[model samples]
Target: MHQLMHADLARAHLHERLADAERQRLAAYVVRVAKARRAARRAERAREQAQLRLRLLIN
Candidate 1:
């Protein structure tokens, strides 16, 4: 009975660790995606600004 209890505790601990690792991975992914989105938005703004400047110069 004692051995079985110890085994159960060990399994629970491992499960908790796995869950924590997965959460960390998900958080990292979110950070990467957010960074990419920010970069894309900046690029879009720059392109729009350039177009505006060209139109002004032509006028």
Candidate 2:
């Protein structure tokens, strides 16, 4: 009975660790996605500005 209780407690601890790791991983992924989106937006704006400059030079 003592061994059984020990086993159950170990299992619970493992599950909690796994849960915390998953939450951290998910949060990191969210941050990465946000950064990627911001980079894309900046690239798009830069492209537009470059094109406008080209048109002005041509005209």
Candidate 3:
């Protein structure tokens, strides 16, 4: 989480349009975005396994 915030802040601060509060908001945003991405990947793998099982059943 620490790295998350640090990386988040650094990324946010890079944006010329970002203000302080916006940068802080970006910390949470970044964390959530990363979490969502990880969740999506897990879901994708699960879906693929389900499809494989369905294929086996069909055969």
Candidate 4:
């Protein structure tokens, strides 16, 4: 999943560089979205692990 996000961002960056002048703006936006998605996923995993640890402590 992380790799997928990485690839998506890379592709978007590449396209931003290669795309026609008009489409480059959208490609840049796509790269930002992909980066945000990757950060969100990492945060979710960390939250889940913390919750699991709290559960273990309570039990």
Candidate 5:
């Protein structure tokens, strides 16, 4: 009976560890997506500025 209890406890611990790892992975993914979006926004702003400069020069 003691052995069975220990086995159950071990299984629960393993599941907890797996869940924690998944949470960490999801957090990292969210951070990466945010960074990518920021980068894209920055690039878009730069493109707009360049276009504006070109139009000013043409006029």
Candidate 6:
């Protein structure tokens, strides 16, 4: 009976650890996605600026 209780405790600890790791992993993914979106927006703005300059030079 004592062994069974120890096993249950161990299992609970392992589950908690896994849950923590998953949360950390998800957080990191969100940060990476945000960074990627910001980079994409910067690139788009740069492209637009370049196009406007070209049009001005042509006119």
Output the number of the TM-score-best candidate: 2
Tell me the lDDT of candidate 5. Answer: 1.00
Predicted candidate 4 versus true structure: per-residue lDDT over 1-59, tens digit per residue: 99999999999998887767668778899999999999999999999999999999999
Q: Which 10-residue span in candidate 6 carries the lowest summed lDDT?
A: 1-10
lDDT, candidate 2, 2-42, per-residue tens: 99999999999999999999999999999999999999999
Q: In candidate 2, which residue pairs get closer than 3 Å at backbone N, Cα or C atoms, i.e. clash?
A: none
Please give the distance, in angstroms, between residue 57's alpha carbon in candidate 6 and its true position after superposition. Answer: 1.3
* Model 4 CA deviation exceeding 4 Å by range: 1-19
TM-score of 4: 0.61
Clashes within 3 Å, all models in order: 0, 0, 0, 0, 0, 0
lDDT of each: 1.00, 1.00, 0.91, 0.93, 1.00, 1.00
- Model 1 C-alpha lDDT per residue in residues 1-59, reported as the tens digit of each score: 99999999999999999999999999999999999999999999999999999999999
Clashing pairs in 6: none
Per-residue lDDT, model 3, residue 36, is 100
Over 4 Å off in model 6, which ranges? none
Provide the lDDT at 27 for model 6: 100
TM-score of each: 0.84, 0.96, 0.61, 0.61, 0.95, 0.93
RMSD of each candidate? 1.2, 0.5, 13.6, 17.1, 0.6, 0.7
Q: What does the lDDT come to for candidate 3?
A: 0.91
TM-score, structure 3 vs. true: 0.61
Query: Residue 21 deviation, candidate 6, in Å?
Result: 0.7
Per-residue lDDT tens digits of candidate 5, residues 10-41?
A: 99999999999999999999999999999999
Model 4 CA lDDT for position 6: 100
Shift of residue 18 alpha carbon in model 2, Å: 0.5
